[model samples]
Target: MNVILRRLGMALLILFLAGPAYAQIDTAAREAYLVDATTGTVLLDKDGERAMPPASMSKIMTVYAVLDRIRQGRLSLEYTLPVSERAWRMGGSKMFVEIGDDIRVEDLLRGVIVQSGNDACVVLAEGLSGSEEAFANELNRLADDIGLRDSAFRNATGWPAEGHVMSARDLAHLAHRLITDFPDHYHYYSELEFTWNDIRQSNRNPLLYRNVGADGLKTGHTEEAGYGLTASAVQNDRRLILVVTGLESQRQRAEEAERLMRWGFREFENFELFEAGAMIEEADVWLGASSTVPLVAQNDVLVTMRHAAREEMTAKVVYDGPIAAPLQAGQQIATLRIEGPGIAGHEVPLVAGVDVPPAGYFQRIYQKARYLLLERQ
Candidate 1:
């Protein structure tokens, strides 16, 4: 059989649009990353891998670590952890728990998530792992397991330290995990406000305050790290995760994050390309009971791209043919490659859609003779 690659313009309705995948926009952050949660497509990236101070944004990981323990049945929301002197003495944000007081896991989680309480994070850390230092080890281990390639945690709170750091991509990945992995607990990030010990504070995430379908996320700021945010939102049933750091102020962080979120949802969209078992091609068969075998995918194919770029997409069918018969239905054989402007590229497996048993003895012999005659000519 010889390799054959055929343009699928006739077989496929690939929309060819004008312009790039998405329009480019300027940003103020030193590092940034944006991704669509529904399709897992990265829409924007700027110095995304460069690890920098994440400030309180690292609290997301701390919350993740604590939630992981709860997820494993090692702890529960009803359980309580004692606040240590170290936890009480922590200088940044506070849940205001008295030293030696036992606090509920539920409230402590809120303190870290909605309140950005440094003291609360330390309490959860020491309670879960016996010490904050030891808990940092657990956080790193969990980070490795979760693919946090450019993150290093020296403490539960994202305090300014010489080596403590996280990249925008790492923060965005963490946000995605929180939203997808712990759906039951993710509501904490969306809480408009939380009160503990007669003190209340609103969620610092700017997107949550707006009507742009934003919910759940954390914001951060420190002299060394400037201001930062890691957030997610759903608009028109589409979810997007964004991580940005190194802005100059709180206002800049909110404005920039919201603008990027709106831009991402406006520019990109999810498209259903094909359904499972859809006949993608009718491939010729050699010495078979049937003249051709249908080709199909095992599952549906979907892609995300900018509006103009989707119109410019192209597709093709590729296979080694003429395929020998006795082919069975659903036999994996061919490939479908799809490409377009603003799309990196996508490939779907094409399987044999129908059976084609070998032909009768006389028919087989006739096909073999015909092949030889054609080759000689």
Candidate 2:
């Protein structure tokens, strides 16, 4: 009886411990979120979707739309934009571009990114769309397409306006999209120094220099909005995005951003879900040149999880099975899902490893004949 009671007590104790194990969730951040940029996993969130004044950080969307135009061949970086009186009159964070002066698009971008130049933003807007109002419309359109549901833009320069608001989660999502979608153009945000017409300025994101792995992002401030920063850092191959808004001072913004980044690095680790071009699994090919084709991920798949729970994770590949032939090498074919306790599941796209052309009529006939002959043997 004593032994049986001890065994039952052990079972009850195990259940008690297991119950809390499943309840352990990462709910850090007072008004913030940490996401896996590649996989879109919400690692942590606190009022993440609530809208608030973004201040100058709204310029990130403006830059994204401009860069998109450049990539689409609608505009060139070398194209010269004429500054207007309206552009020069922008109040906060001026690049000081004089009216009637011609500035290259590249230079203006540097001014806007490194110096947070409202003047530069206006110049780009007018240069691209012939008016800032029209450009603001385009910004709103782009925001809609990119899933920034809570954001709206009333001006191209993110000047104080009634509808110019974005949530911290939205800004972090935008920052991630900027970095991942346009790595070539994203370097402009991290530029520490930029000089225009003999005026030198530096990026306002202070954590860039002080934090170990801090890089590209933006800063904002106004009497109404207070000081805020959207900061990102990569450490030990794991990247984290942090957005802090409504702080008292620039120093406080920087300190809090760094603190949050450190907490992310210390508490969580990135787990690779799939490797680029690596075959995740095989897909059956019917009536094709090959009997089976391999599905792969176009890029490395990764997710952030708490460090202590790394060993308890499982990765599963999910996709339509036995995909038809004539498959293109880069076609998306599947998704890799990573599951673990205390961490949300993350899914990333898997692509075809190699092109597989459909078998010709004659090839199919030959295959059938060979199969029949082999069976007869």
Candidate 3:
């Protein structure tokens, strides 16, 4: 199949309003990243790719690794692990477990996700790999294997270590994976609070109590890393992932996160252009039993654009004129290109909607004659 591209029109350029531009957001956080999950659009990015101290936010990977082990049957939530002297002695938010006591994996998960307990992280690290050093190695290995190219791990607790680091974008990617990969266990992050040994601690995540669609995520802070958070939310069926770091204080971190989430939800809208297998258009068939065959999208096409734009989208459907038969159903024979101002363009595969066999000799002759006549007209 051959395909051609043509510029639809100039009207679509006006999709982004020209007056003073869309409202700009200024953040007090030293680094930030926001993405429209539905459309994969980077709505806001500030040093998103720069590797920096991720603080407790790095625990997301620890949680991820443990959850993966659970999924692989290497570990179970009910399994109990001995708290090492090292874990018990670790400072910063504590789950308050005795050194000799055995703690359930599920409770430790809560300690990390809800309380940001450094001790809990240590317990998990030691329990999973027999030592934090080995677990850190696994962290680096898993990070490289999973496409987190810029992140490096020194330890599981995000305690002040020499080379512990991750990027804002990397954290957002990890958050996406956690949500999509472990739906069964993701509820732990959203839990408002977790209690153990008669002591209860509320989740540190700032978005949970807000009316906004914020659900689950992790928060981090260290003297060196400042404050950081990797947050995700679903509003009106649209999900967004945001990562922010290097804030002066916890208040700034919480405020900045909420503001960014609000802006992402209010400023953009998701448009579903075509559902999977939905006919996009029709293309003429050359010397085929049928005159034409439908061109359908292979998957749902969703685009994100500014909420108040006035211009209609421009779409170009390109394919070889009169595709030659015998065509097979679901064969990719065309391309659907869509563009809009202030939104990234999309090129999606277009498939043949149905089978089209080659025409008989007489039918081929007649089709050729008809084409010639139409050309003359």
Candidate 4:
């Protein structure tokens, strides 16, 4: 079958008067990070990997571990766990549970996520692992398993303890996993308030109250760590994860998070080049039953480009042509090179769409002679 190659835009005709410009705006936070969640592109990073106290933001990891256990069928949300004296006496934030109270796992989750209750975190931890120390170990183990190397947990409550640290990048990554891996439970973070023992505490996450499409995540604060927030927002089907830490005040953390998210969505956009299994071009086949085979993309080709410069987008299908048969389906035979304004060129794999067996000897001889005559002419 014949396939027509899609023509790329004439990008050379357009001149980019300036170099690629990302947001150069200053933020009040000591460390910050932003990412395009859908494309997995890091749009901004300012000391994002410098490990420091994450405050209560680390509680997201504890939530992740609990959700993972539930997913594995080892625990259930309805199961009740006992509150220890350690949980009751904890300071910072409190869900107001008394010692010996049996709290459902789901309510505890709400307390930890929505209320940012240090006491609730301890309760869940001790109940899950018999002691807070064992739970901290489990937290570290889970972090390692999930590739969060830059983070460590000394306790599940993020209660200003020594050696409890997480970088802004790591926090953003953890937020991504929580949203992507446990969609069912992630809604707990977006709950406006949770009440236990007649004490109603609102979610500390500042983005929830803003006009932006911000949703679930966490906020953290301590005298040592300042204020920090790990936030996510979805606009126009594109989601972004942002982390801002060490701001002077809760107001600054909220403003910085919102500003960065706005910049990310305004400056960059995802451009769809081709869908998966779409024929991008055709590749010539030598000594094959068919003279040509279709080249198709293995997955969707989405490129992040500057919003002001998407018209400069262009793409080309490149391959060493006239491949010798027999060719198998799904064999990688070409590369789809794409380039656009304010972005580096990227290559995606293109694979053979069908199998092709070698032609009979006489047929090959005739085709070769025909090729030689054509070349001479």
Tens digit per residue, CA lDDT, model 4, 108-218: 999999888888999899999988899999999999998896998999988888889999899989999999999988888888998889988898888899868888799
Off by over 4 Å in 2: 1-30, 273-301, 311-337, 348-377
lDDT per residue (tens digit) for residues 1-377 in model 2: 01111120111000110111222233223366666564565655667888888888888888999889888899888999999999998888988899899999999888888999999999999988889889999998999888897898888777888978889889998999888888898888778898887888888888889855877788988887788888888876667787877788777777777776787678666666556777656666656789777767777766555655535555656655446678888888666665666545656667778889989999888867876786698
Best by TM-score: 3
Give the range where candidate 3 is weakest over 10 consecutive residues by summed lDDT.
9-18
Q: lDDT value for candidate 1?
A: 0.85
Clashing pairs in 1: 15-311, 16-311, 16-312, 17-311, 17-312
* Model 3, span 1-377: residue lDDT tens: 12333231211111222122244468887888888876787778888899999988999999999999999999999999998899999988888777889999999999999988889999999989999999999999989878896799999988888888999989998898889889999999999998887899999999898877888899988888998889999998899999989888878888889999999999877777678988777788888999788889878977776667535556667776677889999999888766656445667778999999999999999999998997798
How displaced is residue 16 in candidate 4, in Å?
11
TM-score of each: 0.86, 0.75, 0.87, 0.86
Q: Candidate order by lDDT, highest to lowest? A: 1, 3, 4, 2
Positional deviation of residue 358's Cα in model 4 after best superposition, in angstroms: 3.5
**Candidate 1, 1-377: lDDT as tens digits:** 12334431223323443355566578998898999886667888899999999999999999998889889999999999998898999998877878989999999999998889999999998898988889999999999999999999999999998789999999999999988899999988899899998998888888988777988799999998999999899977789999888899889988999999988988888877678888767777789987678888898776788766634667666677778889988897777777766556667788999888999999999988987997798
After superposition, candidate 3 runs with Cα above 4 Å error: 1-24, 284-287, 320-322, 364-377
